[model samples]
Target: MTITENAPAGAATGADGVEHVDVLVIGAGVSGIDAGHHLRERFPDKTFAILEKMPGRGGTWWTHRFPGARSDSDLFTYGYAHKPWRGPSIATSEEITNYLDEVIEEDDLKAAIRYRHEVTAASWSSSDHRWTLDVLRGDTGETVRMTCDFLWMCQGYYNHQDPYRPEWPGMEDFRGVIVHPQTWPEDLDWEGKRVVVIGSGATAATVVPAMAEKAAHVTMLQRTPTFVAAVPKTHELAVQLRALDIPEDWTHEILRRAYIEQFNELTRMCLETPEEARQFLLGEMRPYLPEGYDVEKDFNPGYRPWQQRIAVVPDGDIFTAIKEGRASVVTDTIDTFTETGIRTSSGQELEADIVVSATGFNLSALGDIPFTVDDEPVDVSQAVTWRGIMISGIPNMAYVFGYFRHSWTLRADLVSDLVCRLLAHMEAKGATTVTPTLRPEDADMEIRPWSDPENFNSGYVMRSQHKMFKQGDRAPWTHMHEYAEERHTLPAADLDDGSLQYR
Candidate 1:
């Protein structure tokens, strides 16, 4: 493991090393690291580079240095499968970011990381089967169009764009500072002000409780109720088990497995039997609210549990905050923003000193890049997800994306191992490039019916559902809701294949 640290403190880098690499992995997030690590493992002689846009690595971790940002899922399943997360049960944004840094350090991946080299666009040449990337370095203000054999897009949907703020009727009239949880403004002071959080997703859930800890009053505004699920890191059995000679690594693995197993089944149940799922979810939520609070009205979502993402409360801590009157959930759609507060559709205007939009992210398809095949434009929008790994008709391009239902890294890890297998298959067959085309059966788009409907709000699902790479079959094939099953599909599989057209 050799890490070459040439990146000085800046946003971009200029022309320096123009050496040819076999693969160019864009975005140095969990996906990018997997791409590089897997590529290096499968094709030991092949060279790859991770071009990160930020001055440093850690995509969302670095970009979103928000005050109360943390993982909604357990940290055990959040990081690289090879490297476990050595932090508290629920990892803070700082912890996850630091873990990613540690991954880079442990694997010596920094040498190949071209930090601040933001890729603007990628063009693939058909005759040469190579991708030419136009990248801008933040520090040097230098732009270079580098060439590579294959393009591995690890840039998760979210980019450095401002969140979408709807035109609330009197929003422009509000004198207070309006903020989106995505692009947080660090210097803003909300010490003792009344803060109203918009939307009912995990972001809002995360912000409200943490803000209530400091703010005078934190109001969580929701158009529809969001299903809240609370799971503790240590149950009675796990607590007793941890006291023995059980290693922290093994303990985390077991906890990650157990939680993923439960969430996976819960997601499937929500999709298959929505009403039953709703009833089950409400059963869990009812105990958190006070007397006379309608579970169906305040906590029951219009959709099934996984239909929209079930908000993780981390031991029902957020509900406790609300239970203690530190936080309140107002179930109403925002009619508009007033100078002093937000007015709901029910004609009630609440006073607020600050308004935060936790309204989800736009479908950011692989860093919003236009992919080309053999110099001709290959429409990715037209492709179907080949088990959510490789795109049809496009040769040697892999995209790393995660499930909204399960941990993001679980799927990424699968794709990483699959990439390794595909590389080995290509090497054994003496093929320069491999494209996994969709079988005739997967030509239509039904979304496999298992993927969390919240993905509809995700940037990838919004923009690229029409793509051939979108999974047709849900879990075990296209979707992996469990860690144990994913291990069977990923790092454990053989790379030999008959799907390639050899050179």
Candidate 2:
């Protein structure tokens, strides 16, 4: 897909010197970059631009400058379907950022991006059939107005500013330095100093092995256990194919399909027989642990597999660190923070010179951008998502939210495809707008949480439940994590399903 030099005719310019385009994509992350490429290919005549809040590209990778920062999912599927990732399965933060930069450079997307331009609010105009956005310039305390035919929210779901850190008594009394992984200090020096990492998620798992290389000792303090698994650097089939001199792109595609298929079956197993799935997952980890190790106590989680994200360690680095006496796991609740250490509820005092809280992030949607419809403020919590992309009563707008079970970009790719179809259909019918509205028969349909609470028990998601959009109990209204179901349904979905109202 090549970028066209010309902008579409009759592009709207708002009252406050607004710059308009055919589409306004709100982010320069993976989703934003993916959407840009698809739009260029699907609608070559239309013009669009990406607004990035950060000074650089790579939304999550750029912002998160923590030590041992890397992807929990493999690069093959986590990567865009259009792009081929030639690196190892698990890539570091810097590596991922560089990959994004490569995409931006090769695809000529840099010209279409405006860094440090944060979109503050977006209001839909019914009369003009457009969206007027209020964007704040990062360098200056000024607002830049913009108008668009459609708004694409490629911003991922997570709060960047404030991460979730629970208050503990005597935290002020702790003499050791406290750090959160989200805001890791650049000049931090922990060499030969005792370190305590809190939480049991992927962040904690990654940091422990990484910091153990320099720190005197690293202790992973967790209130509850999480499912941790080891993944190889490359798929066996890809490795075999490469050995036989198969082309890189072809090998990557083979591996990508294999991973997707494996995960799709795993997702089905989780939904169908959760207990069996949990046992199978634990069984995979048993061989990595020391003899007589309590897999149930340390490796097993309370919830079923895929409910919360499963943590993946590249080549079992964390386990190696523990086995070699460089790191250890302490399963207990923190009673209080003492001057030089933390006291546990079990009356154990763990000495530490530095404490890192890998607690979790605050979940936010549309980059927390305020939205309005026809000059009226839109309450996202009351809105229902149409196939996890378009929201009910929202005109010519779509948000790219990925699958929680599989690699995020898998669903993003599908959403981008559907969006292109929607835009093309609108053009063919001479329609200026398309909005998913609840039908009369759907008035009494039971409204539930966006995801089933039992199947999604992540602390960050549960805490921010009130802020997320709701979903219906039926088809086209539910947000599914199953890639197989979405892969087949979304691309062939009926445009005139009595939900999407066009004008």
- What is the TM-score of candidate 2? 0.96
TM-scores, all candidates, are 0.88, 0.96
Q: Which candidate is the best by TM-score?
A: 2
Summarize candidate 2's per-residue lDDT along 236-268 as a digit string, tens digits.
Answer: 776788789888788779889988888888888
Q: All candidates' lDDT scores?
A: 0.72, 0.88
Per-residue C-alpha lDDT of model 1 across residues 138-179, encoded as one tens digit per residue: 889988777777778898867467465556788889978889
Error of 1 at 445 (Å): 9.9
Q: Which candidate leads the pack in lDDT?
A: 2
Candidate 2, residue 263: the lDDT equals 83
Quote the positional error of residue 469 for candidate 1 in Å.
Answer: 5.9
